[model samples]
Target: MVGERKQEKDVKREKVRGAQDKGRKTERKGQKSKRTECADFTDKPRIFPAEVIAGKPVDISCTFDTTCNGTAPVLTWDTPTDVSGSISNTVTQHGVTLTYTSVLTLTASLKHHGQTLTCRVRYPSVSSERTLILTVQYAPQDLSMTSLDMINASLINIIEGNSTVIICSVKSFPASNLTWRHLNVPMNRTSSNNELWLVIPHVTSRDTGDYECVAENEHGAVEGSITITVEHAPRNLSMTSLDMINASWINIIEGNSTVIICSVESFPVSNLTWRHLNVTMNRTRSNNELWLVIPHVTSRDTGDYECVAENEHGAVEGSITITVELIICCVESFPASNLTWRHLNVSMNRTCSSNELWLVIPHVTSRDTGDYVCVAENEHGAVEGSITIIVEHTPQNLSMTSIDMINASWINIIEGNPTVIICSVKSFPVSNLMWQHLNVPMNRTSSNNELWLVIPHVTSRDTGDYECVAENEHGAVEGSITITVEHAPRNLSMTFLDMINSSSVNIIEGNSAVIICSVASFPASNLTWRHLNVTMNRTSSNNELWLVIPHVTSSDTGDYECAAENDHGAVEWSITITVECRDSSEWTAGLLTAGIMLNLFVAGILTFVYVRKSKTATEERVAEISDIELSPSPLTVKHQGKQNMLLTDPRNTTREGETSAPQGSL
Candidate 1:
């Protein structure tokens, strides 16, 4: 029973706690549903419009709505986001669709680029956001600029003018406008002949300045500038004379600005300057004309003055002079004179002296007439003059009054014979005339009044002037006569009388010889000969002369001659002969000497042999004596008284057998 009561109490308490927990769980479920169902458009995908409404600012936005609850919801739209233009956007409530109205504004600025319109919508249970592009549809980055330069203009200076052109070009995408300005001031620009141009006719100093070209486009803008200068021709050139009192002057002159007034019918104008004497004057162009003002005047400046002009076509020059002095006085007509003519030997009155001024000429001839001047002078620079004096003349009359052929002229009896010429003439006084047969000189014949000439063998060497001079108290005169020589035939001869047979030789060595050549000539001739490459000596001799040879040799026999030459011609005669020597044994003199020597030797040997043999034979023989005995008895003495008997006088002739002879004592 106790267990039953505990279970019942626990049941009642648990029922009450379960009811409270169920209520709390239901409230938590409701709070979680509300939180999850709230609408947030940022979390969902939205579509933006392709093309924006042109010319206006339309802003795109996102808004939230929690009332709608379906797949496609109805919506409401409001104003745009961009403030540049009026907002005109419309939204339809068929699920979700939005469209913008157009307020077109074509005059848009660069800031309108990429502008867009916004369309915000409200739905019953859902929300959404979208944007539509609002583009001005303009050209971008359209502006550009370029430039060119002008250089090296030599023709501009030579042409004496100024011309120019601009080369800066401008390009833009939207066709920008270009304009030119000078020093920041707008310049006149025009379109003529389908091209933009800036023409400045008659350029002046004021035109030289900086220039600018401004280009503008819808996308951007650009500007550029250049410097320009204008030039003009030379001017104000003039010239003047330094010494006008001395008659010197020029029209135009200047140094710098003065233009050399030159005609420019062609392209280039000539340079201008001044010239005087042998030097050129330095000057420059100033205003209009070339100006030349010399500081001083001198004699050196008194030469030809010239103006020179030149161009590319050609050049020319003109000249004049500056005379420094003027003539003061001149005169004419003075003294009268008589004229006459005469013949002098050398020159026709080379000089006239005061003594020769007497005008008394002798033996009138035609050589002395010429124009003579006579001047007279006095105080004021003295002026007195006369005309020419004329002298008329004729040949003097002369003849041979007496002629002596033996004394002056003759004919030759033989060749080269001399002669004399003698002739006399009668004029105011007796005059002698000389003569010459031919051209050869004639020795002077006489002096003073009478002339004489002697000639010897007149030949071609004597063809010249033969003069006869006559003199007296009044004056002197000369008569000239030329003598031409006649051609005289000349003759000359050379003779070789005995040239060959005079040669001599020796038949033995070491002998003397001679060879003689006789050459004689009428007009004198020369003789020369050679032997063994040596010239043989020649001595002038008569016909029977001799040539001596000191020694002779075998080589002496060769071509030998004596060449004789004269005025006619020359001739050589020669002789060649060889000499043979005989043997020594064949000579009589050598044989006689040998024979005499042999005879003498043989006679000496024979005599010596005979004497020696005789001696030897005698040595070989023995001596023998005869034997006879005599017995002596007494000595017989015969005294002086014995004239008697002593036998028949022994002084007489003895008989064959004698009786007794005297005995001697033994």
Candidate 2:
């Protein structure tokens, strides 16, 4: 029994040892399982509000579920170099599980934005980490403007009709809202991240103003501004007068003041100037208006004036005409020699001069109207004064004078001949005179008081009542005269009565033979018959005239002339009358035949002479040719030597083989 007790004690001892070893192995396995478990925070491993604004205070907390080990867990935070914060930890237990919390307090800024913030939990076995990406929301800062086109300047300048854009740049945590404005009015814009563009298309002078670009976000708003200057040329330029009826022209008396204004309608105010005679004049400019003041105007100041406006774009000008009128002082005078007056360097008669130094004309005539100079002479020197005189009068005694001195109201002229008419008038002031035919105005060569009207070729159409009209400032007067154009007689002829077959009258001795004279004339011309250079009594009515002889006799056989005369002139026709005796009729026929035979005989003799002369010329030419061929060579040489000697010495001489011929020999 003692031995059995000892073995049992030993087995018990082995059993105790085995149980202790198993307990130690279970402890090691529990420690390994705890290490493998996830140590993430109970809350999400991220920041509370996924975003954070720069320069703003924020709270970041992380919680981790720890294993039941009875040991405290450490919490740590990792942050950027620009960020500083305090981290605190709190531990809680639930049954066998332990929870650890870490809290970080810091002010977030732009530097911390878009960075990761980490929170870590440290335990005996392993550590747990939580990461938070910082989304810092901040206002726009460092706002500036950048030009996108040709307008790359602080102050934007663009010509009319050009386009440009300016961008506003800024720095912000988030994309900020952008806007563009001009003169407090919203402008069209295009926006991008951190930049806004203000677009100006087809810029003009009307678009020139201050412009603003604004960038805004939930945090704050910032703006940038630029000045836009739209340049344009001068336009709608004009000149006007304050002292005249017409805007473009003015007439002012000498020594009077006048004002001329120049205006321009343009942007970026144009410079205005006044010019005269192509030279710049003194002027004052205010805004778009320029003023040229003439304090004391003179005759020399009368001319064309120009108003010019200029800008960077171009120049424009307008013109006005100024006329300076002469200031006249009136003077009256009566006939007297004490005062001497000269007009245009000519002395005035006593009838025009007066004792009064100032001239006072009673009846102002054109001759008295001029620039008159008065002279008062002394032994020392001569003093002179000048004045301009103007006279006014009415026309009087308008008259028409023709080339023929006829009645004032009636005249007679011939057709197809040049006719001249003078129209004259008498008036105190010279009048304008004109000539008219049948109440129609006629063209004339005119002088001061007379008008000469010439008709180169007068026709029947030119025959009418002519009028001379004189017109003046007061009234007009006219005188009329009737003109009758006469044509000479035409187609004048004389016929014999009682002779049907012949132009000559044949009747027995002491018997009666009648003759008739006819003609065509404008005015009935007085007709008469002249027998043997002596005029005979005749009767005439209208264009017809009759001349009668009671008895036919030898005296009537002589030449008879039918004559017609009037105011135009005279025309005549002649005819011969034959008084035949019945007993001597045969003798008359024989005498006529004998006269015809004598004429034929004379013609035959002239023809015979012409033929004989032609035949004689032909015979002479043949004889001359024959003589030349038959002449001897020695004789020819002798003749040639004799001719040469005669030419050399004027005296006639003979050669060795020749003899002298008679003076008439050929």
Largest lDDT belongs to which candidate? 2
Per-candidate clash tally: 54, 10
TM-score of model 1 relative to the true fold? 0.22
Global lDDT of model 2 = 0.62
Could you tell me how far off, in angstroms, the CA of residue 612 lies in candidate 2 after the best superposition?
99
**Worst 10 contiguous positions by lDDT, candidate 1:** 640-649
Tens-digit per-residue lDDT, 506-531, candidate 1: 22333444444444332334455556
Shift of residue 342 alpha carbon in model 2, Å: 23
Best model number under TM-score? 2
lDDT of each: 0.37, 0.62
Global fold similarity of model 2 (TM-score): 0.42
lDDT of 2 by residue, 346-401 (tens): 87632223334433332233445457676654333445667655433445445667
